[model samples]
Structure formats: C-alpha cells, structure tokens
Target chain A: MPFKDFSKGLVKANPLFVLVLGLCPALAVSTSIENAFGMGLAVIFVLVLSNLIISLLRNMIPKDVRIPCFIVIIATLVTIINITFKAYLPSLTESLGVYLPLITVNCIILGRAEAFASKNPPLRSVLDGVGEGIGFLLAMLLISFIRELLGSGGLNFTILGYKLGEFTIPVFSSMPALFFIMPTGAFLIIGLLLGLFKKTGVLR
Target chain B: MKENVKRVVVLTIIILVSSLSLYAYYTSTEDLIREQETAKLTEEINQIFPDAGRFVQKEDIYYVYSDDGDLIGYAFKATGKGYGGDISILVGVNNDEDLTIRKISVLSQSETPGLGTRITEDEFISQFNNKPIDAIKLRSNNGEIDAITGATISSNAVVNAVYTEYKNKIKSIQR
Candidate 1:
C-alpha cells in the first residue's frame, strides 16, 4: 500500500490544519485535556469503523443510494457509541453529552469514508482512517494542553481512581486568566494557532 | 455474466459479515453499559450524601437512606431553559425537605463558559447545600441566593429549576 495516502493526512491534508473538518468539537471540547482526549478517542472509533464499513460495502451501494447508505451506517455506529458511553463511561459521557451524537455530522469521518475509503482498498482505507484520526487527535490535544494550563492554571485530573497531580505553577494558579476558558478564547486560540502553523511552514 | 454474479455474491457476504459482527459486539456490552450508568448515579449520590447506605429511584427521583435505613434525603434532577440552552442539575433535599445538595452536577448546559458556567462552581453550589427550601429563589427576586454576575439568566435558571422540582418532589416524599 502506498504510504503517501496515510502521510498526506498528517500535514498536507491535515484534518484541522488543512482540511478544517470537525471544527465545532475542536473549539468546544478543547477547554480541558480530559475532554479533548475523550473526544479524540470517540472520533477515532467513529472514523475507523465508518471507513471500514464504507470500504467493505463500496461496490454494492448504488450510486443513488450511497449517501443515504453511508448516513445510516455512520448514524448507527454513532448511536451505539453514544448509548454505550451513556451506560459505561458515564462521567465522560456526561461531560461529552450531545457532542457524542454530533459525531454523525463531524464532516471528517463522513468526508473520509466517502472520498477516500469508497475508492481505496480496505487496508489503505484503514490506514487513512488511522492517520486522519491521529492528526485530529494531535491538533486537539495541542490546543487543549495550552487551554487547560493557561485557562485553569493546572493540569489536575483523575481517571478511574488514578491520581494526576495538580500541576499548578505559582503565579498562574492564584489568578488564572478567566478569558482563556471562554468561547471567545477558543476562537482566538484556534485563529492564532492557525496563523502560527502557517507562519512556521507547518501547514504549507 | 458469471464474473458479475461472483462480484455481487462476494459483496453481499462482506456486508453480512460486518453487520453480524457489530450486532454481536453491541449485545454483549449492553449489560455492562447499564451497570456503569447506575454506578455513576450512585457515586454522585454518595458525593452528596456520603453516608447514604441505600436508595430508591422512582420516576427519575432518588430517595437516599442512611446505613440504618432511615430516610436521609431525597434527590431529583432539575432542568431549565437557560440563555444558551437547557441546563440540567441534580437536586438533593435532606430529611427536613431542605436541600442537602449532594452536588449540583451540570448534566447539560450551553451557557457562556466562564461567566454563566460558574454556577457549577463549589462557591456557588455549596451555598445551596444546607439552605432552606423556601429561600431558594435568586437574590434578584428578593431571595437569599446570589446570582453569578453576567449570568443572571443562567443562575436564575438553576435556581428556578431547583425550586420548581423541590416543590413537586417534596410533596411525593412527604406522603
């Protein structure tokens, strides 16, 4: 399989940097690292599974019915994840809430399955899914790391009873700038990050 | 003709296999999923009433009991229409029907993050913990509770939701 298809998504066709898909979740959930990680994994699951299923059925789906077929398949997978999360990982599910179901229209997953997976071999398609998923994850985590540290003044989190130490630096902790955690702050962060990526030739 | 038929058969087989695999995976995990949701509610209750040894749920309201099985409190969810969207909070009331406020966890909210969302902060939520039920109205309405600045609607939404649900839920438990 040509590795170019996979590598392209990392930079040249990067989901956030270049393709600019799934921006809503990127902006909304990047307030905290924990949320970003949860959203990233959820994206990975949806992207990979949707790609696999679309690739497997690419030939059989009629041209007229393809879009509807893809929608049904993607919606089904999203609902399953939504219900499963509601039942099992309730805290993450609670935090994520409607964003879980919003995965159906995330654009990245559907755009990939339709444009790449439907035309490629299953193995190549899977690799594309993984590459794009990782790219999305990388972008979100980077944004979240900055947001959490600056907005909340700490990196404190505990998952499944595991203690993550409070990483509060002296000055930032006491009077953490509240603006960094607001909606407008997210827009500013993404805009600045986009410019930084372009200026540094990270997105050229 | 034979080649076309072969391709059709192969595609059908693949679709069948994929569908079956997903169905199996979903069914097997369904039970675990329900348990996790129940455990989450229990954990939330325990946070509010740490000594809650048992509880009963009816119509989405939870009645928490102590280790001695005495009624400690009653809890129910309150949902309000806020400026951004629906704001849902879990409301807990003690044996006196006064709020014990196990914890006011935001179930869903779309208020402006820093300004309105601070309603979920302990400084705000803890105020409701042991307060009298009748005094739950927002301070703007001449009640005791203070509204978060720039978030009167958000704050009021929570206050109103809690008050409305309390009035309703407290009646059933009193009976």
Candidate 2:
C-alpha cells in the first residue's frame, strides 16, 4: 500500500525538513542556487549508490557490525565521486571541498540504508533513495535561489556549460544585503522558508 | 547440514566480491586520478600566464617561459594560516617589479561563509592584479585593498599573505 518504501522519503519522512539530518553542508553551501545544486547532486550520488550496494549485500552484513560496514561503503562511494568530479568537474569539486567527504555521515545515506533499504526489496530501496535525493535537491535549490538573488543582487552562471543571463535586482544590486550571504543568512532563509511552507500548507 | 554450510559460503562470497570490486576500481582509477590532478595545476598556470607557452619548475617555484623561450616571470604558491584553514595563493612577479598576482585561490579555509569566502571573489582578487609589490595591504592600513566588511580575519589573511610573500621573495631574488 505504501509502495514498499520509495514513497516515504518524499515528504512524510523528508531528510532535510522532516528528519533534520545533515545540517552542516545544508547551511554551509546553501548560499547560492548553484552551490546548493552541486551539493545536492553530490549527496544524491552518494545516497543512491550507497543504498543500492547496502541493500544488495544486506544479508551478508552482520547486525552488530552493520553500522561500520555502511560507513565504509558510503565513504568509498563518496571518494569515487569526489575523484571523478575533480577530474571532470573541477570547479564544482573545488567548491564542494570537505563537504563531499562529509557526505559519508550525512545521515541521509545511512538513514536510508537502515530505515528503508534493510527492510525493503533492493529495487524499492533504490527508488526510495532516488525520491529522497530529488526531495533534497529541490529543497536546496529553492532556498539557494532566493538567497543568491537577494544577497548577491544577481545570479550569474552557466549550468552544464550553458549560460544563464546574469540575474540582478536593481535595488539589491545597488545595496546588496550583506547578511543574506552570511552564515546567519542561511539560517534566516531556511527558517523563514520553512515557516512559509508550513503557513501555506506546502509541508503539511 | 549441507544447506547451512552453503549459506555460509554464499555470504562469504558476497563479502569477497564487494571488497574486490571496490579495490579493482580504486587501483585502476588511481593513475588517471593523478593525471587529472596534474592537469588541474597546469590549467591554473596557463590562466595565470595567458602568454606563457610553457614553464619549468625549480624547487617549489614555477618559472613561466614564453614561446620564444624568454623568461616571462616567476610564479610560486604561498600558504598562509587563515581564519578557517590554509589560504594558498599563487604569486607571480614580472621583471619590472610589477606583480600580476596570477591568482589568489583559497585551497582550504573555514572562515564564516559568505563573509570570509568573499575574499576569493574577483572583486577582492582584482585588487592584486598588476598591483605594485609594495602596495599590498588593507586600505584601512593605508593600502589599496578593501576589506570585506565583518570578514576582517579572511581579508587580512589574503593581505598578509601577499605582503609577507612579496617581501620574502624580493629578498630571495635580490640575493
């Protein structure tokens, strides 16, 4: 009835808003839409692959040592992605830095493995991973969009090598709010967005 | 009894397979990974010296040479303790005593995001481009570079790094 487990990570058990896991990179890199998108994709890659691998080998992992095993698997996957990104997407990799490696403990990876993968069929677990990943990506991208536009007074980027025109708000451009790009800015944006979501029934 | 033994063997086989797969991936990709890293440095060097046809390395310094084999300038990396972590900057000096700054990239830093990271922004690094070697300091300190508001630690880190490196490198070149 619940589509096994894939449907749960969307909203009822969202990783960022609902579960409140992996707040470090969420706050650290969410200043701009581009940074948030890259970070989200990196997290997705780590989560989905780790879940699939763990689910496939769930039977072999002993219960007592399962946590350690999951960590190793997640860490190795993260390293591979990190290396590949460095080779191919040097700019994004440089922007990511330690946050890439820190994905091993992002809670979303291990949380999915333990909460959903272990209990569900391998295919369902994979879908669940995808759902949660998309959810996180969407949430991060939205928050960063507002932050970058407001804080920097402009959004200039070339996504996948295609240029998006420089976005600038005239008022903010002339006098950009310094706080929107700060650590506290991330908190303020996310908190207000969360409140807005609740008030508008977007989260309920 | 036979079924139980078979189950044990299967589990062991899965463990071995997974570990071997990862190990194979790591081993095969290691060389390619190293090459990628070298390519990155080479690319950065090219950006710093658009006219530099090639370069040579002596010790840790890179000597950029033009197509005609003339010495264009000397570029070297400097690491300074920043608010968050090590701030690595590429310093290039021409024969005329003018500095190109080449680039001032943050290799790693933990300073407050937005505020501190802004130090790497072009507006900040642009201040160093073509700057005379002696004029590297915070505008507040009677130099030309403007400090990022509320990010004095990060701002000062870049300023100090350039100042200290300029002084030391000048002395070394003179000797």
Candidate 3:
C-alpha cells in the first residue's frame, strides 16, 4: 500500500550511511557475517513491530510525553526479543551477549518511532520499518562480508547447530591480517566504505 | 487539569498492557529456557568428565561417577573479574590427594573480540588439562600456563579464578 514510502529507506535515506544512525551495533557486531545478519534480523523484528504499534498509538500520545511513551514501547519489544532469542537460539544468545539487549537503546528504532511512525498511517509506517530494516540489513551484511572475508579470510553460515558451509583461503586462514576482526578494523572498514560510497555517488 | 488526568490514564493503560503481555510470554517459556540451561550444563559437564556415567550436583559441585559407579572426581565453577566482564571457569579435578585439575573450560566470558576471545579456543583452554594447583598461574608468574597475546588480563582472570576457587573448594571438600 505504501510501496513508494518503503523504497526510499533502502538507499536514499539509509540509516547507516546517509543518516549515519545506529552505528554502535553496526560497528560492534559487524566483525563477522553471522553476527551482522543475526543482528539485522533482530533489528528488523523490533523495527517492524514497534513501528506498527507506535503508528496505531500516534494520535493518542501527547507531544509532551511522546518520547517517554516511545521508549516504553520500544523497551518492551526489545525485552521480549531478548528473552525469545535466549530461549530459542542459545549459541547466538551467547555470542551476541550484551549487544542483544542493548538494542533497547538503538537510536534507529527510537528515531523511526518519533520521526516517521508517529506522523504516518499504520500501513505506511510498516513500510518505512521494512524499508529501513532491509536497508540496515544490507549495509551491515556488506560491511561484515568485507570484514569477515578480508579479516577472517572466510564467510561462515554457521547458526544454531547448522552449518550451510564455509569457504576459506588456506594461507589467509593460517596467517590472517587479524586487524579486520578487531575493534579498530570496524572503524577502518566503515570509514573506507563510507568514503567510497561518497566518491562513487552511492551516497551524497 | 482535565488534560493531565487523561494523559496519566492513557500512559497507565499502556504500561499495564505491556507488562501483562510480557508476563504471559514469560509464563509460557520459562520452563523451556530452564530446560535449555540444564541441557547446556550437562553437555559442558560431560565434556569435562569423559568417562562420567551420571552426575549428581550439590551446592554447585558436580560429583561425577564412572560407569561401574566409582567416583571419578568432582567439578565446580569459579568466577573472576575479566577484562570485558566476569569470566566463569569450570574446573574438573581427579579424585587424587592433590585434587589436581583434570581439565578446565572457560564457561563464559565477555572479553574483547579477536584477542581475548581466543582464550576460548582449544589451544588456550587445553593448557590447563591435568595441571596441579600450583601450575594454574601464568608462565610469567612462574607457572606453566601461557597467556594469550593481547589478552593477558583475560588469561590471568581465568587462571586466578580456578586457582583460588580450587584451593577453597578442595579445602572444604576435605573437611
């Protein structure tokens, strides 16, 4: 129904690049492809659900207390997600650790709730949520694909007792650069990609 | 005054609905999460005591038994302040006078990525197998265990946790 509204979030108003929001999880969890996608899925779940709820309640909430109301709703959704992940995906639960719960504070969710969902209709808000989520997901996957490939020298599809497969470069696996897997690597790669995007007119 | 009352009523209703939903979900899944935690602990315990037939736990100690019902040894957990956060160590000891560590595994840690997380790697955790209490310290402290490079704090945290907890646990078990 809101098809036009959804597509813009995928690139133009992309949260990670043009908006430069939600950088904390983008950087912290982008060490591996597995974490990146895993984090992305969790964000999408929260984003879509929270956006829909906030849109429905938009008319009822007073401007003075709107921020606190959004916080409450977002925090509740994140807690539900946190417990669900812990129960169903214990391995991911461990690897993700604190960042999973820290999703409660992710600015992207709060930002969308206030800026878009509060002003938009329910269907349109849901579109924005999906578009933004996919955009964020694509950005994270790109950053981590490069990080894991260059840093760890491979991409892992391993998830809760399931390994689709892995491809590795033997020499790199044995003596990897190791920088891309570190905290500093996140900054360096994101910086380079951001610059490239700007230079190539992918971002302006 | 009328507007303020309406705002309070609406916010209260929203909170009540949110909490009720959470409670409903929690009641449904609490048992499943508990079972998962138990299964994980059992798996970790089995890895520590290879020949263990069945284990009985009391006050945080797991009493391991052989297939024929002989006491193989005991295992317990230890905690230390790590670089990232608290590090939990599972210590398996043989039924010997010295209670030398039969093996050890880093149960949980929040250490830094790449460098510190390597402590969970087989190369690092395997070093503690069959080492005496005295050998639990790092090589720098004149013990056998080598600290993982760039993660000395995490390595030392694991070492000190097992060493201290083992000493205290063994003393109490003997008494």
Candidate 4:
C-alpha cells in the first residue's frame, strides 16, 4: 500500500503530463538538460519537505487559514533552497533567476499540500511527494533532452557546475535547428508531447 | 468564537516558526554567498588583466596594479539592455592618455543563441582591444567597432554600454 502511494506518481499521477500541473517551470527551464535537472532537483527538495511538514501539522492547521499556512511553509522552503543555491551553486542560481523564487506559487507543491499531504499521514504524504517530484524530474529530462539535442545540436553534462562530458552530433552540430531553443520551441514541443500522451492513452 | 481563536493562534505560530528558521538559515549562509560573488569578480578581473596584481575598488571602478605594485589600468563593468536580457561586460582600459581599451570579456549575457551570442566571440570582442574609448561606437555611427552581421542589437548593446559606462566612470579614474 505504501509502495503503491509512491509508484502511482511515477506514471499514473505524473504531475507534468497526467495531472498537467506546474508547466511554467517546465516550459521555462527545459531549455537545457542541465537546467532542467537543476530545477527538477530544487522542486523535489521543496515538494518532499513541504509535504512532510504540512502532513505533520495538518491537525494543528485550521481549515480556515490552511492555505496561508501552506503558502508560508512552501515559501520558506523555497527561500532556503534559493539561499543554498546562491551560496554553493552560483551559476545555477544565475540561470534559474526569477523562476527559482516563483516555485513558491507552483501549483504542484501547493496542490499536493492541499490535496494529499493535508489529508494523509506523514509517511504517506512523503511518499506521494517523492513519487510526484521524481515524475516531474523525469518529464523535465525528457523534454530538455529533445530540446537541447535538437536546438544546440549537442549535449553537455554538468553536475554542481562541473563538466562531466559533452558531444556534438556530426551534421546537426554544423546546421542545427535554432528554433528548438526558443520559447516558441518550448511551447510547440510541450503541446506535441501532450497530444502524443493523450493519443496513446498515457494521459487518459 | 472559540474556533476563530484556534485559527488565529495556529496561523500565528506557523508564521513565527517559519520566519525564525528562515532567518537562521540566511544568517548562516550570508558569508558564503558573499564570498562566492567576490571570488567570481576577482576571477573576471584577472581574465581582463592577466598580469594584474592587486585591484582597488573606488565607487564602481577597479584600479588594476602590476606585479611591482605600479598602477596598470582601470577595469569596470558595463551593463546594457540586450535582446534577451541585461548584458554585462568587464572592460579593461590601459592607463594611457587616451585610455585605450586593453581587453574586454563578457561577464554574463542572455542573448539569442548562435546569433546574439556571437558577441562573446573574439572576432567581435577583439575589435574593442587597443581602440580609443571614443571609438567604441559601431562603424555605422562613424566609430571603429563593427556590428555583428546578424546580431546588430546585441553588438550595439555591448558597444553602447561600454561607451556610456566609460564616459560615466572616466572622471573618477582621472581624479
């Protein structure tokens, strides 16, 4: 039962595709695999912790003021993540910019707090958070892989600002499709993916 | 009436706890964050002035010194509104009479890839080197700089920023 709660979010309740929540960061930061990974990690950190805290305090939080309380908790966690990133990962901090702070209002975090965390026990809520967070991460990676590969004609891997390895495709590197890196590309790719998922019944 | 009191108390407690923890975390990481920024600035300065020894900051300008402690040139940041976002350039100027540009390195930019981003290439940046401050404008403006073929806006942004910022900061360096 506990495992079911965790695995459900991986595909069935996938936050980006299934539930279709939190597309702002998805579209904005999915330009590069590195940026997508960074944003995904940050989201997971906030989601898991916020879920745990909200679930533990569900009883103490009154129904009338629960939304405000959840916002406060989520905002606090986001700020902490921002400070940590600025200190240790300054490059990522610069890249993420306003989108990092905007995570406080990301419907996924708040939605989970209101829907799953506030109603379930702490353990179950945490599992839901992890499952949903990973689902978001996987979706982001998939989108970025396509965008960065087609847009930039290459892929570069970095962990904590350290370059792991990178390679460029032969033909694509010389004459890559520049459109794939733009905002228009993001919208088009996401829309097509959404359609594909629905057609294949992954979303249904 | 009693339920209202409970709501107020719980909300108040939550806010208080959140603020306290956030404050604690911020204080702990404040020094580390500041250190990273300063280190980054120093590295950028060194890149612009490879042989630079010590740098002194007065206002927004940095006075670069040689290994023997003699003043070599001036270095400062120029910010311009680019196509995507603000473009920041670190400019190095020789201490000559005309204050000719020694070198320039882009600190940060968010311009379009492959086009606007070509501003960072040596082909564009090299044009600024050893040129007089007055010649910072594009050739279209009767100046020495050449605008990137497809990235006029991004190129113009860097040229204009360097010209404007140099004019603004020259007086302080001259003093």
Better of 2 and 4 by TM-score: 4
Which residue pairs show collisions in model 2? B84-B110
DockQ of each: 0.29, 0.28, 0.56, 0.86
What TM-score does each model's chain B reach against the true chain B?
A: 0.83, 0.75, 0.87, 0.94
Hey, what RMSD does candidate 3 come out at?
A: 2.1
Instruction: State residue B84's C-alpha deviation in candidate 4, in Å.
Output: 0.8
Clashes in model 3: which pairs?
Answer: none
- Candidate no. 1 TM-score: 0.83
lDDT per residue as tens, model 3, B97-175: 7778998888888776667888889999999988888998999899999999889999999999998998788866631
- Model 3 bad stretches (over 4 Å): A159-161, B111-114, B149-151
Q: For model 1, how does the per-residue alpha-carbon lDDT over B1-175 read when each residue is reduced to its tens digit?
A: 7666665665465557557766887788888887886787788888878899989987777888999989888888889989878998887777763444445666678776557778888878877867787678887687778998888999999999988887887767643
- The alpha-carbon lDDT assigned to residue A92 of candidate 1 equals 83
**Which model is ahead, 1 or 4, in terms of lDDT?**
4
Better of 1 and 4 by DockQ: 4
Whole-model Cα lDDT per candidate? 0.80, 0.76, 0.88, 0.92
Question: Candidate 2: misplaced stretches above 4 Å?
Answer: A1-4, A157-162, A198-201, B1-23, B81-86, B96-132, B138-155, B169-175
Chain A fold similarity by TM-score, each prediction: 0.93, 0.91, 0.96, 0.97
TM-score of 2: 0.82
lDDT of 2 at B57: 77
